[model samples]
Target: MADLSLEQADIIGRVALERARAGNSQPLTVVVLDAGGHVKLARREDGSGIARFDIAHGKAWGALGMGISSRGLAARAAKMGTFFTALAAVTEGRMVPVPGGVLIRDGGNRIIGAVGISGDTSDVDEACAVAGIEAAGLAADIEER
Candidate 1:
């Protein structure tokens, strides 16, 4: 398994910020997590809310923990609210089932990390994450079911 490098994580963060700015999105908070669900990089834009970091981290952490994009988790949560509630409690509220979390995969199609963004609509946050991952020459896995 390949590890996500600091350089790659930096690029992801930078490009994500750029994407958000280019799109005229509200200030954003971006969090990149290693496959092990550790924060590799986190960036909070100037006007982003204070809670954005936690929300972003939760998105990425949930994706890593569940082995799927947060969008998929959102769908699952809708279908199984009780289970998702339990999952949230089990994770100590670290799991956020939403569209902003995206899995990052290396060239060989192996997941190396995940990126999460907040401070905008879930769809917009997800687009920024995808843009950043692609900018870093990695595949962005978004489960939109």
Candidate 2:
């Protein structure tokens, strides 16, 4: 699979931030991860909470690590909280079952990375991630479960 470049990651971050601003949401934290589940870039808007970055990272990592959107994971968690909690422990608290993490796919439909957003409602956060991924000329896999 192809890797998401720094330039693309930067674009995603910028676009996500802009989307959050346009919606008048809370100061957001955006995190982008490469195909290997490594962080390529991360941004926390001014006035964002201190733990926002951690939540963003966890969402992205969870999506990439599980090969599914964080929203899907969240859905599963809702149905199986105990198992999902175990999953969280297994991931050393890296995986977050939330609605903001989405997969980024390249032109050939290969997963390139993931993006996670925080500081807004789950649906709004997810919209920001999708917008950023699309703005970067990539596909956003925001699975709804």
Candidate 3:
């Protein structure tokens, strides 16, 4: 499996921030997590609330831990309701079943990590992640599966 290196993490963070700005979205906090759910990098831009960083981290951590994109989790949450809430509780509130978390994959389609962005609409945040992964010559698991 490919590892999320510091250089790649930096590229992902920078691209996400730039995409957020280009789209005229709110300032964003982007968080990248390795396959083990450890934080590779986290960044909150100026004008973004501090909470965004935590939220973004939660999303990415949740995705890495659960082995699914947060968007998929969100959809599952909608159907599962309190069970999903309980999952958040069970995971110590690290499981953010929201739309911003996305799995990152290498060329062989192995899950390498995840990226999460906050401080804008969830859709916009997800877009930035997808863009960043593509820009880095990687792939988003959402697109693959």
Question: Pick by lDDT: which candidate is best?
Answer: 1
In candidate 2, stretches whose alpha carbon ends up further than 4 angstroms from where it belongs are none
Tens-digit lDDT track of model 2 for 38-92: 9899999999999999999999999988899999999888999999889988989
Q: Quick one: ranking by TM-score, best first?
A: 1, 2, 3
- Model 2 clash pairs are none
lDDT of 3 by residue, 62-108 (tens): 88877889998888888889898898889899888788899998988
- List runs of model 1 lying over 4 Å from the truth: none
Q: Rate the local accuracy (lDDT) of all candidates.
A: 0.95, 0.92, 0.86
lDDT, candidate 2, at 31: 96
Give me the overall lDDT of model 3. 0.86
Better of 2 and 3 by lDDT: 2
Model 1 lDDT per residue over 94-129, tens place: 999999999999988888999999999999999999
Q: Give the TM-score of candidate 1.
A: 0.97
lDDT over C-alpha atoms for residue 111 of model 3 = 90
Worst 10 residues of 2 by lDDT: 1-10
Could you report the Cα RMSD, in angstroms, for every candidate shown? Answer: 1.0, 1.0, 1.5
Q: What's the distance in Å from true for residue 39, model 3?
A: 1.1
